[model samples]
Target: MPFRKFLGWFKGFFGKKKIIRLGLYGPPNAGKTTLANKISMDWTGEPVGKVSEVPHETREVQKKEKVTVKVGGKTIVMNLLDMPGISTKIDFEEFLQYGFSAEDAKQRAKEATKGVIEAIKWLENVDTALVIMDSTRDPYTQVNITIIGNLEARNIPIIIVANKIDLPESNTKWIEEAFPQHPVINVSGLTGSNVNDLYSAIAKYSK
Candidate 1:
């Protein structure tokens, strides 16, 4: 069957809505872009955004459409927005490793500061947010808490994605325990693990 038809059938089987919106948000290098790429590929069969090892690779919000997902026996069309990661401080050290001269690094550092501010400003416009976090790192960063607190203050639904679950040092349980009130899902973007559950959770609350 055609992929769209298959998606439609799948959606019909699940009883999901016809349209949904999701915003992917997280700190730098926490797999926000990775998860976004995975979801875009799974639903549309193509990548909608760029993936990079460097922090702040996505400086702007990249959106991809034609996402056909099944929830509660119905097909729902999703418009996924992949946003730039947030950080309290710019990483000039990593920027220098990208082969940029000291002058260029300094310039980019300033640009990164603007980018972080832009990302925080953009959060207010999103309907729902998926806060991605690296499972191997501590989730106690100020940026993480600020994003969560702002989202909660605005009453926007949120899903905390603990990515890189396949990594040996991943500690998703700790994240869940730390943010007991927020919904948390363990996933591996590289291996496409536990993605369906994440999608399902987002779909459930979004509707």
Candidate 2:
């Protein structure tokens, strides 16, 4: 090989890598923020966002930058993006069941609608995606399918997270069976169960 060509190859091989933009995506109440918090807390000693039982509590995309994760001798630097939960519909009446006043529910519903659009827009900017699913719930849903389809269409590396495995009703197998084409890791974001498995997967699969 020519000396110039070899020198170029050497620099390229040892060059600084671009930071990955890792987006966490799922339907409402699927524990996206909880998992983001867990990952952030583990690597950066900080939480990404507040988690709430109320659907659409996270009405905007939350970002934690420069989180360095080291697992199994591999290190990856990423900008963790905790996205707003996606949904087919956001009705103010639903919040009433959670004791939200009519006016506040309406306002929340409006903000949530905007959030979903924002998340979809951010899809184009994502380098890798974690499509989180609630293992206790049925894996076959329009929201889940749409999320996966969008990521696949964008040719983004996908890592499915079967979250909430600490719950007795969780069936991680269902998620694996539903999307055999992608990698799945079962973990409990709330309790940190099997989170190491998730970290290893991230190191292996992230772009």
Candidate 3:
């Protein structure tokens, strides 16, 4: 079946009058913020989250509500939560790029320790999660696997968003093969490509 058609049928079968709680999560620079912004813009018709090129730009979780998504002929209400990027260690590279001294970078990394833990804690409460990944790169990071495994352990449904598929090096098939157990959708946040398919997929799991 065509990917989009499969998603549509999945949504129609499971997405009905459900108040979906979705958590957007990924490693640094994986386009988590971009995906969040696109979903917010598409459903709310406004920017509900910020988009930045730097890693860990979102320090706190941003919540938006009343996101109306039409899936399978039903308009489902969605509560979107945009979370800080999860990283095993403080992004020293990003910190140093900002002109921080080694000592200062170390200190900031220590401070960011709490943020990582908080982000993980937030995941436990979410009903569903979107694991964003950069399609241009191999999806073999420990952080990504940990997040996905934890959610799976808890029986929380997940959808992997292979963001940045429009990039020259993006490879969706490799990602699909890498994570054979989960569903993955190739998306381009910059141009809003495959955004509806993502919404429909999430709506399907929301049921």
State the displacement of the C-alpha of residue 193, model 3, in Å, after optimal TM-score superposition: 0.8
Per-model root-mean-square deviation over C-alphas: 6.8, 3.9, 6.7
Worst 10-residue stretch by lDDT in candidate 1?
12-21
Error of 3 at 145 (Å): 0.9
Clashes of 3: 0
Stronger candidate by lDDT (1 vs 3):
1
The lDDT values for all models are 0.83, 0.93, 0.81
Model 2 — TM-score against the truth?
Answer: 0.93
In terms of lDDT, the poorest run of 10 residues in model 3 is 11-20
Q: Count clashes in each candidate, considering only residues at least 3 apart in sequence or on different chains.
A: 11, 0, 0
Candidates sorted by lDDT, best first? 2, 1, 3
TM-scores, all models, native as reference: 0.86, 0.93, 0.84
Residue-level lDDT of model 1, residues 1-207, one tens digit each, is 979558857886897544556788888889887888898888788887788887777887788975887766756678888888888778677688988788877777777777777778877877778999999999988888999999999888889999999999999998998799988989998899998888788777763
- Candidate 2: worst 10 consecutive residues by lDDT? 4-13
Global Cα lDDT for candidate 3: 0.81
